[model samples]
Target chain A: MSPTCKLTYFDAMGIGEPIRFLLCYGKIQFEDIRFDFEKWPSMKPSTPYGKVPLLEIDGKKMHQSAAICRYLGKKLGLAGANDWESAQIDMAVDTITDLRLKVTEYYWEPEETTKQKKKETLLNETLPFYMEKLDALVKENGGYLVAGKLSWGDFFFAGVSDYMDCVVQFDITKDHPNLAALKKKIRELPAIKEWISKRPKTTL
Target chain B: MSPTCKLTYFDAMGIGEPIRFLLCYGKIQFEDIRFDFEKWPSMKPSTPYGKVPLLEIDGKKMHQSAAICRYLGKKLGLAGANDWESAQIDMAVDTITDLRLKVTEYYWEPEETTKQKKKETLLNETLPFYMEKLDALVKENGGYLVAGKLSWGDFFFAGVSDYMDCVVQFDITKDHPNLAALKKKIRELPAIKEWISKRPKTTL
Candidate 1:
């Protein structure tokens, strides 16, 4: 019997979306509980870490997005074939996370001067640096993040890039054709495709 | 025979130190390459992720401090006994990382006003929130971060808290007595104790 799974996150395709996408791709059934931003203030006190994207497996709740993803990735046979390959995939996922945090900081900056400065840096420096590096990795790794095949890192990065796109409001994929293609490929997967068709729409 | 390992990072006990502590605790011999801040600009471009704490297994390099730590944690039998326990450990490690990044942002913030604001939040809210949660985990898990015995999460958090302390200049553990005990227990391990005695000291 499959384990009962439930996920809680704010109503947006933020970090929580990756876990949803992964579960959908694995054909695993889970309750997707999304709430509005206003609800988070009250909900915060009840969360596992006062954070969203909490996953309940067999009634036991777990926090940490990457950890939940890794567990699901391992369970779904999407992590990697062996320990070394798993480490490589983990490296790629964390690298994408590093890139995500950098981008998110720009989105979260409250002051106008700092926000403009960060946007310039993101557009000119940070995006180019990470895009070039990761684009090359995708090209070299046979269109996937690691081991020349599909892994959780691919889905994770693909989901993260969507959030990045929302933050930057620029066609980030224009330069990184390979990564763009990879994202398209991930979206085209049967399970993911179906989920995308049915999943709730949100501006973010 | 064991694999030949070489670790390259700046001449500081920052990200690289955890990798060292893990390797030392496992009694794993590795070449520790430390360079000063002056060398980083020239060195950065060659790194796997353009970041330090690069672990070279044999001759191939891998990046991402958490990924490297996870890899070393697995190889050293410090990950956990099984996948479930491993997931729990991963959860704890990533939570600490989230805490670390939040604290480090204060250290990295350049604008005086922003820095002061972040510092105020750190002192009044953030540190206490994480410390209480994690300290409870240590106490509940029988004196370790996960499981009843030592795990990599213990060492990783202990290492990270030292970095956190360097950034905040506060005795974060003064109120969280259990976490303080956990840190002490991790430090008292023979290998880590020896490494601490001999390793070059850096403020951060």
Candidate 2:
């Protein structure tokens, strides 16, 4: 049976975007609900973990965006070919997550001086190190993040790297040919391309 | 052939303990390598992600503690009964990870003043809310974090929550009856009990 699905998040390509990309890639339809930050306080009380990117399946809500992606990846056959492959996929996704948290740590800083310091650390040291390593991984895996096949890791990296690129406000992939190609490849997919064409745009 | 495994992290339980607990739960043998902070900078360059909790399998190294846990969960037949249950397991583990990170953010702060303030926020707001919710989740699932069966999520939580309890310098389970019971149930298991009996004790 086709389960009713709804995804709720702030109107931005934060963690929510990857889940959206995964659903679309699988040709699954869901109610994509987004609201402004002003609406979050009231909405927070209803969320499972007081966080966005919640997935409601047939009215039963579940939290954690990465977990959701993994579950749906399995159901959609985007997980991996086998358990070992799944681990590889998981490893790739999580490495990206660590990189994401570095930026989020900066975002959550309330002090301007501390925030600037974090931004410098992210740009000067963290970003180059992680991006370069990941680019090499993609190349090693024959242009995908793992197993020489398209998995949730690819969708995850493709989704979050877009946000990372926007925040860094530069062509993050300019120096890495394979990662640039990965972005273009994922972006050009029929489902993702269509979703991106119509999805709400904001300066995330 | 069974692959040889080596798990490396600091001498503290920290993230490595959960992975250790999972392996021990399965009665899987591994080389546990622990180091001190003084030795980390030199070791960092060789690590896959420049982080600890590195798992080396048959000479190939990989990173990400949670991902490593998931892989071992499957291999040990402690993941879940099926895809849906595995999703629930993933959800539980990731949710606990979210809670753990809130505590780690404070742990990473270099400023004593900032650390104390963060500790206050954790004590007054974060710990109570999350522990209460997790307690409820455990009760709802009938004394386990996910399925009624023992899974890696249980081991992960049992291991990390111990560190959380120590860092907060109190028994966080003091008020959460279900979580307390869950912890007791896991800790008393034959393998976990045996591992705890012999593992090195650290302040963290």
Candidate 3:
């Protein structure tokens, strides 16, 4: 029998969404448990490392979104065909993570003036720098993120794209045709399409 | 013959050290190319993704420190015994990364008052929170970060511990005996000990 799977996170398409995408893509059944921000203070201490997007497989809990996604990717046969390919996938995902951290920094800036300055830098410089490189990579890899095929790295970007845009308040993929196309392709996958259609809607 | 390997990074431990530790631990000889900050402006553009700690194996370059370390970890047989074990190692490494980010945030804060505030919180709350948990984990896992044996996670933490201490202005492992012991053990390994003695000294 399949191991019982439960995922707990806030009710938003943040880091947790990538794991959800992978589970759905692999046709795995999981209980998705989401809570509001108000409950986080009480919930935080109980977490393994005081963070969210936790996955429990067969009563064994694990933290870290990227780690969980990678685990599932390997299990689902979407990680890579071999070690080198997996490394390429990891590199792509880490690059995506680097860009996401910038957006997060801007989002979490408390002061308006500082936030605006970060916003300008992000939109004009950082986004383009990353998107262009990522675009060229996808184009070279035949519309996928790494190793010339679909991997968890693709799902990671697709899963996090909406939350990132919501935080940055911009269409991050506006000019990056390849990134936009990749997102479209992932969203159009049968399981992912169904998951998106049924997943709970949240402001961010 | 071993692939011609080249690693390029700034002349400090930083993220580059983990890869160095892995290579040295595996006894693989490679070119360690270090550069001063003044040269980075011109050098950045030449990097695979405009970052350092870039590893080129047989002329194929890769980016992202964690990704590179993972790749090297797998190749050097320090990753894990199997898929689940690798996932556990990834989780531990990611958790360590989370704490490192907190230290980095405190280190990079510019305003004195804000920096002091962050420092107080870090020392009083964040450090203890993570250290206690990690100390317990190391104890449980037989003085290693994951899987009751040595892994890249150990190399990663040991390699970065000094840099982390330099940034935080605290001996992070002072009270964590298991963590301290793990670092000492990794450092005392023959190749790692040799690498440490021969490595270029820098203030970080």
Which regions of candidate 3 are displaced past 4 Å?
A1-3, B1-3
Ordered from best to worst DockQ, the candidate numbers read 3, 2, 1
Q: Candidate 3 lDDT (Cα, whole model)?
A: 0.89
Show the lowest summed lDDT stretch of 10 residues, model 1 chain A.
A1-10
lDDT of 1 by residue, A1-204 (tens): 554899888888879888988999887899898999888899999876788789998567788888888988988989899878999999998898888888988998898997999999989998999999999999999999898999999889877787788888876777999899999999999999999899888866
Which is better, 1 or 3, measured by TM-score?
Answer: 3
What are the C-alpha RMSDs, in order, of all predicted structures?
Answer: 1.9, 1.9, 1.7
User: Best candidate per DockQ, number?
Assistant: 3
> In candidate 3, residue B204 scores what lDDT?
63
Measured as a fraction from 0 to 1, the native contacts recovered by model 1 come to 0.78
Q: TM-score (0 to 1) of chain B, per candidate?
A: 0.93, 0.94, 0.93
lDDT of model 1 at position A33: 85
Counting clashing residue pairs in each candidate, in order, gives 0, 0, 0
The fnat scores of all predictions, in order, read 0.78, 0.92, 0.97
The residue-level lDDT of candidate 3 at B160 comes to: 79
Q: DockQ of all candidates, in order?
A: 0.81, 0.85, 0.88
Q: Candidate 2: which pairs clash?
A: none
Model 3: how many Å of interface RMSD?
Answer: 0.9
Per-residue lDDT of model 3, residues A1-204, tens digit only: 654999999999888899999999998899899999899999999998999999997566788989999998988888999878898899999888888889888988998998999999998899889999999999999999987788999999998888887887777888889999999999999999999999999867
